[model samples]
Target chain A: MLDGLIVSIDAMGGDDAPEIVIEGIEYFLKHEGKGRRARFLLHGDQPRLDKLLKKNPLTRERSEVCHSPTEIAMDEKPSQALRKGKGTSMWNAILAVKEGRANTVLSAGNTGALMAMSMLQLRRMHGIQRPALAANWPRPEGISVVLDVGANVEATASQLAEFAVLGDAFYRALFKKEHPSIGLLNVGTEDQKGHAVIKAAHERLAESDIGLNYKGYVEGNDISFGNTDVVVTDGFTGNVALKTAEGTAKLIGKFFNEALQGNPWSKFTTMLNSVALIKLKKRIDPRGVNGGVFLGLNGIVIKSHGGTDKVGYSNALNVAIGLAGSNFLEEIEREVERLHDEDDNIGFIE
Target chain B: MLDGLIVSIDAMGGDDAPEIVIEGIEYFLKHEGKGRRARFLLHGDQPRLDKLLKKNPLTRERSEVCHSPTEIAMDEKPSQALRKGKGTSMWNAILAVKEGRANTVLSAGNTGALMAMSMLQLRRMHGIQRPALAANWPRPEGISVVLDVGANVEATASQLAEFAVLGDAFYRALFKKEHPSIGLLNVGTEDQKGHAVIKAAHERLAESDIGLNYKGYVEGNDISFGNTDVVVTDGFTGNVALKTAEGTAKLIGKFFNEALQGNPWSKFTTMLNSVALIKLKKRIDPRGVNGGVFLGLNGIVIKSHGGTDKVGYSNALNVAIGLAGSNFLEEIEREVERLHDEDDNIGFIE
Candidate 1:
């Protein structure tokens, strides 16, 4: 039997607060087969959590409620939150991981504050300058991982190369793929295209013996087409592409709905085919993949969408538990150390 | 009566060359109300052009065939095309504009070759360092213009600010909206969120008295939400976002199609609502907005997608004719000069 993994949860964060968080825990316990191999550390107002947890005896039996009087607001500035967030639920959850009481932390909170607190408490890994947020994007074949979504706006050539290694480790850990094909996102596929940083990063990644199956450059359309297993880019461009894809999907869905409701015949036809449409909708739903993992930190931290419901929040918790159960952190640390050793060997040879 | 505007067309370019190009011109002359106010300078092999023109009497009546024995291949490198591009049809069309024989040029040729030839022949406008390709993206309310889609991959703060002015003028010429609201595309809406270049550009745009209704920073989702009339960014980021949006739309469309063909019932539903669905498809068709206007050049040049059909080709021609009829080039030149004059005045005052 595997050792029981403990996931720290910031129950006071997100738009729905402790209610949705508790409900999500119940949903995960009910549906997830791996739920029996995990324990939970719920950080929030003890009184409210205790009341909510009473309805779900199984979750209450496997979870502990820790008191936290403060919570970060959704729109609070990162600096202000850092100054005043010592005892907040998000801070406490991260602290549990930092103190070795939990394997990982999961929060549906303000992304900037969560990233800020995680960086401060856990610190970056030995060879990493900045941590990146890796998002699991839905594609036709399966899902592809895209990194630096909004963690850092700009990335240097070295930082981009680091992102490739981080993304490679992430895909291996989550998908259990031995080697995932990685691509650097660019405007064009040619090596000569894009800016100097991208070209330099491409050269660095191509030349390095970092054990990554580095495919050359890929364009924006390749993200949805699943042309590569991992798509890496600077945070500003990645964030824009991610949000634009989301917005476009939403717009098309709206158009689809409007088209189905145009006439009586169309309405009847829609009713007849509602099941198929619902299946397609479920296949492409963003709620199933709601977490953005903060890579390159000493411990794992997952950020869930603030407005997600119990279903979405449960999915995020599942991702946290999955990462916690694996040796993801150790794998990344070992890879980074190995790459540094290789660099040292190259230096001596030169 | 309006003077007959001449639009130079490269009949040898695009996937469906002389046939589709000639058919598109016929289609435009058949239905377009402003067809009587414009004439076409058809540049290609004289024999092929004459044969295609014989089939469409109206197009032949309104168009004059120009002999161009050489043609640039779609896969030809920009440098190679630039070296030996004198007698090519794409070259002749642009040369007509440079020599003031045509008000504008339209080509569905290779983008790299078109950009290179336009830069070498027509040249850049005074005070403009690089030209930008501005694309009209469809939004729910109407349309928004996004610039530097794939022109120069990297941009300085001043270049980004200049794009805002170029985009503003393009929007005004096309949509007839004075003082179109412009926003800088960034990872977040907050002032301090993006990279140093974006921050500096934000300051430049916000503080300048350049007669622009600057709306500050906008996120990627804002492009489809129609939050701003113009969205400006570095070419690499803009190109990625644009292609990502296109890819997302395509993926959703595929899902929609698959759902509608799942069973006999869905097939029936699709049959019943075919008209409404077709209307929706037409509303969002990329072919209707096929042209990407190359801004900041001394003369106007429109690039059509190389694989587009007659419908798409006609739309590109319409865009060229529309801009040619308006004082689009003069508007850009005057606005750029005004901004430069203001900079000089500020320097003297300091």
Candidate 2:
């Protein structure tokens, strides 16, 4: 019954709504979406989307619009979003996946609203107490995934264990790695380092026979080291760390510009090295890593940065298409069941 | 009677000890410590200290070596250090402050051991639950201070409130800013964004008017914005954020280096911009900003990086001399008492 990989999109969500969304799809179909059977179910005001789609021929050829009368505010509270936000573009975007009309959902909307609506409609996968937002973190060489970036403020030991299983499957499904290493983010690498919750989660990960590449504990530096494929932590710590890294990257970029443009001679020399500088700029470009995949949900949901441009949104769409085309959801279901089975066996053995 | 600001130094603590310590003192005496009545009591093997001190004319003239037979290892456990670490150079360094022989203590030793011995010797000030380690965080313009970087794993609401007071006095003394704005670090700026602990701290700081500048909440990005002078969080989150920023800075530096060396033209251009690059290097140099100060203790104890060079150690020595001369302790005591009085009045009003 499924006709190719369908991506449900909230076209009216981000700062520059239907414009960026339509142009982003067009950009992706030309760049990253070539030769792929990626179809989009755009959810937004039909009048505005039609106008934008007329301007974007590639997106017009590959997508169908679903009329949505309302759009959630960017700064709306989650509870308020769920109360009066049904039938809205953001809500219907997730509803399409819940109704099995779409393979995955992608939204550049309010993260809290997207998370809230996803939980209300699709619900958590079997044995998943909490759904988490796993982000694509740029490492020293390649990319790694860090989970619970900002979905839940806190997580129990078992939930952290489930995150590992989910994140492991995520990395494996995306990169096709067989045994990607997992590291629990802690204050120190020692067994007796962080809070009681962290220690408990560490113990469960260490003792469980979940068959994961469970490396012991890791410090904050390990997140950027690239040796570890998956980094796990509660949402509070993960959110702060993510933003801190982002702020640091921006500050360094500013410092780099200042370094190159101090004087006329310096500026001229910097212009001469523009080719290499452009190459470096592409490598550390934030657009390359823009999507945050919502794991542990029954259906796939990817949240893009709310204030991103067309290029960043297109990168997120590239991720959504790649994940939609794969067996990512099925892989997670199998891993989650195996993790719970290990827990049950441990409970009985004890 | 105390003649001048006598600084007790753990000369045998760091990776390259006695050498860096002696050289660092000489460097500080010539630079930041010029015309300051700062005397040093170096604690280590006397023969080694004597040899190193003799090689450095200024340090030899200003410092007296205190004989200590043992030195704590770089990676020793706090409990083990507490039990068997007595009479060691680190322990004796704190002892000099406890006995009023020195105004402050400085060490480039194991952080856990330094914290443990300082607590055993100086103990916490009145109305203070746990001591906190405050580090200087470089902002976009000026510098800000973040507390509980690695002192305690968790902090209660009242402890977080107390950190505002301690960090406030710390900022004022170090920067001569009379009333610096304080911000509590959280996942988001919303009241309902983070864990209950964070919410409670927010409420406590919001309601209580201890006549301090307490801005409600800030995210990780705010730390580098330089708008807020003091950022407060638990040790777990603070430690992770600090290290995460450091790692990001280093990674960016690596990327910049790789960017400039891609081809012959880039190499020549980069060589031409060497003067500007050197200016950039000095502006963001980690050596200029070194040292972690232990607040809420009866005496001042500064922790320098264990693997830092003489330049880094000298910056830390500069902090030690500055704090030793101020009434930083008295300011915290007065603010803490006023905070408790406000709590009592609130209880009565209710």
Candidate 3:
């Protein structure tokens, strides 16, 4: 029996639906042996989940399948879904966290709907001017946390500063880094490089003693390197940049495969250089690190790709466990309080 | 003796300087063979270039070296350097294109400096609103051209429409497509998804006809795929997204190598998957497609990376020749006129 933590998995959330999600959850449970025990609650149509359970026995001892009648489509407007689809797998998963039935929630479908449901259900942490969604981008110096990927399109200087604090907390909790470096994404690294919003935020970050090893301004190209552990930006630019990177990686992979596949000579070359190819694939695979946790929310919430596979879904569950096991909430609260005290001293934003 | 197009390469440009640039020019000449006779005039410190040339026996057969007294620092402000460093390799290379000594100009140096020099020397095309920097991103179907990567940060609706025209012309000419589909990059694909600039530009694009197949709006995630032939945006978002993708690819490459090189078992696995690794590497390697061609200028002006290697420099030279080989200037002029005529008749942009 799992007595360590509780995590709710949206079994019918992703594009491939119950089959992939169920298999992924099973894989995660099997891999995560007896040492780290977490109670798994599957939220979806009970009948469907039961059918899958019959096919594959989940390794976890303590688990339950909760029935959620409805579902939000990938194309549905987030706000509308939150208002109407209250019984959806996504909504139920969020509701579990709200009711203390689950300490964390994981969903691999409809990111917008998940975010909306999370905000509406869990509510934001007190003094969080705006809730931000943080994603982990694998950098040369390990992984960096980038917040405001798509939570709020427009933000004030104070909100950007808040994101930095939250991101620093996240990096510390997950990576166990001390005084993680924080950077503000701008057109250039110069102090006077970006627009008015960024300039104001830069000043705020500089002045604030938020316990961050503030790295000052960082350009778009520096985000991928080990240059900074946390990058803060407005949702518009961050969201676009993240999606663009993902799309570009996929495109490059497709092109590379097509250009070097299906020929005798090509196959021979491929055999000769198989080591490099495997290494490269592992490096760019989004599934290698799935479920970007929605930081700054009351509880741990993970946003996975809508088109995720079985392995991807499984990875999302593991990410939720990581967030919970690392004591993310406690760390964030402490950091938020530290920032709050500093803000109060310097006349904090109301 | 060169019979075809001629391109002036800034030999002193980029981080590696005259050595790598000279080698790149030699590689280009050697690969071009006898039939494709294109002259590459290396512009830099004749003495330094001569010393670098001694490493390789490259006679002035299909290539020549021109003396440029000064060199532009990558970190120097563009406006200040443009006024002071008149005899720099970057400035002289642009001047060569303007003076009809070279049909195209390519540089692996400061992008801002190149843009300033190109704008001052060749001048913007008549009827063209503002010059836009275009980069070709590989996709599943083929490659798509993205415009205004970093030319004008705050662009007007008129400028974006003009970019649409230039991008359409370039896409058609290079891809040899009868009707190239063009998309305006925005937060969402809906008509009213973005701010004032995008809203205004969306209306303008729908009305303007430079023989473009208007594909409405495209989101960031769709950029790497051939959802549209040409993706148009203001420099601010475009530049951030492009650099982010490039940086992400570089980081991914670095991270994988580090992770795989840790142990003997992983190294053996990596070796076995070498074909996949090379295929993946080829996908993300910026050297394969190094430069962003400055469109809407009177002549072909290519902006290579400031930290370009020999292969990257060679690719930039190849891109310049490709631009010069095609009737870019004439087509750009014709497209502007066509767009203007259509806009006038339909009353698109006021």
Candidate 4:
């Protein structure tokens, strides 16, 4: 157990690829201090990786390199690659998790492909109709886990309620927060509002004996304010909201850069403001919270951004390790079993 | 034509109703400087207003006070209010726009009630299937307009395309940006992705002779960035994304306030950083944006936040004045007619 857990990294998945991901891992290993308990399985071309390691040499007793000859194209359809390209890095990483060669899997590849592969290969826990992609985002009030960010856009009310339960379990295990509040994302907070499906799910959630800190309904704005700890929504809305936030931040950065470039005085001000800007960027960038754990799956699968750098990929790897090290998967099952025992359909909608 | 541009204010709407709304109007009247024009009709309890105005003075003579004996509670059911609460502040405000008593209406009241009343009274535009609530939110890059924000949760491809047109027109009129770039909000930037309706709309938009800067596809994160001038999505997703952005800003503000609450040293640092924070806040705050315009209505109908202060309500009134002043309805009609004349069905899927 002290050996911790090993996470396999698909070093070729993201935009920056192996270089930045490898550099980031090196940074962590060198700076993370002693007593950091975790091992790593970095998968990529051995020759390409050796060159990187030779230049930035570090002790790698706890890390191993796994070579994969095939690389997945970013633009290729996830389904096609999953079926036809078994030798690709993505397929190998999934295989690693299934074989128990790696405790968890982390990748910044095509999200759709990752979700599809996990669902088809790893399968879902008993009673789970659909697994969810839960994004743990830091809000001003607290952190919120927004589930189904893009896993399944259209879902039954029962699926939404199940997502809520899974999200609750995930948040509780990860954050160790007592009674994390669960909110149903809707157009309004009114009891009479929302679509037909949400209405049914709301009723089911209200009646559940799963000991959830149910907070009724919340809107998109509620997520950032930490008004609710676990925000449950259909994948369509959650995905849109998450992406819009990211786009807005990027736009803001661009505008500020242009403004600062207008004059020397502005440049000085920008320099003075760099510390605060960096802090704010760190606070808002989704990359900082790089990995979104695929909840309700048989084993842990953390999905990182496809545009991740070494820092981002390593962050994803670390998140996977942390989840595995903490026995997060076991605890989630326990919570679900407890909820199921209480009602057997605590998250089911009639 | 000048008389066809009067704005009636529901002084009873919003958190700090009447007083702040009144004060905001007074500020505009005093500071409007030159060439600014519009008449104001204040609809609320006249007795209380008379008492309040005794302490605050007005600069303009284009003011009329209409008595609304009853007030709709902020949290009251909008459906009930629309059907039953005749002669209430909200109802009178709607009547002002519908009956041509005023060219535009501005109310910081129950959003649901306002939306219900507008749809029922003003009716949808000719050949339009749905009316969308569009708001121009200030982002760090520039102003981005997001539409169908909770007016209707689900919308068809044609409806969304119509919203794109409406948003484009509004952005052009208000910001003076010629031929603004319009984006269909989706989870992925790829053409084949997104729900069936959106994919259909995307195709339609691409082929149409709509004289729009048709930027292929945008994800949610694209909203805050100047990447797209107008972002269109179904009401359910749009509303959630807008609110989530607002909530996040608020939470961030709260965090900063709490972090810098005490100690002279920290206070000094905060004061030093206050300018940046204020600038950022002004750019992100929905209240700063003030009103969400109900497009495709017969007349301008501005929906203000129920929790807004008097200043916010006044800003809502001002937004209405600007919308009317700009002859936004006429422009939209012209644009719609142009699109209709093209006889092009804008969509990818049938």
DockQ (C-alpha based) per candidate is 0.73, 0.74, 0.37, 0.45
**Top model by TM-score, which number?**
2
Candidate numbers, best TM-score first, in rank order: 2, 1, 4, 3
* lDDT of model 1, residue A175: 88
Docking class of 4: acceptable
Runs off by more than 4 Å, candidate 1: A1-3, A33-35, A345-350, B1-3, B33-36, B347-350
Taking the tens digit of each residue's C-alpha lDDT, what string does model 4 give over B97-177? 788788788887888888888788888777566789997777665678889888887888778878988998888877778
Candidate 2 global lDDT: 0.89
Candidate 4 C-alpha error for residue B207, in Å? 3.1
Name the candidate that leads on DockQ: 2
Across A1-350, the per-residue lDDT of candidate 4 in tens digits comes to 23666777776676677777677677666654245766667777878877777766652556677888977766777777677556667777877888898888877777777777777778998777789898978776457899889887677887887788888878877777878899999988888878888898888778877688888999877778656889999888888878766655565555445644555654555565555556655666666678888999888888887777655666666667667766667766776776556555443425
DockQ (model 4, Cα): 0.45
- Candidates in order have lDDT scores of 0.87, 0.89, 0.79, 0.75
TM-score of every model?
A: 0.96, 0.97, 0.88, 0.90
The whole-model C-alpha lDDT of candidate 3 against the native structure comes to: 0.79
Write the residue-wise lDDT of candidate 3 on A75-122 in tens digits.
Answer: 777767877767888888888899998889988778778888888888
TM-score of chain B of 4: 0.90
Measured with C-alpha atoms, the lDDT of residue A265 in candidate 3 is: 63
Residue A230 in candidate 3 has what lDDT? Answer: 93
- For residue B33, model 3's alpha carbon misses the true position, in angstroms, by 6.1
Note the residue pairs that clash in candidate 2: none
Better of 1 and 4 by lDDT: 1
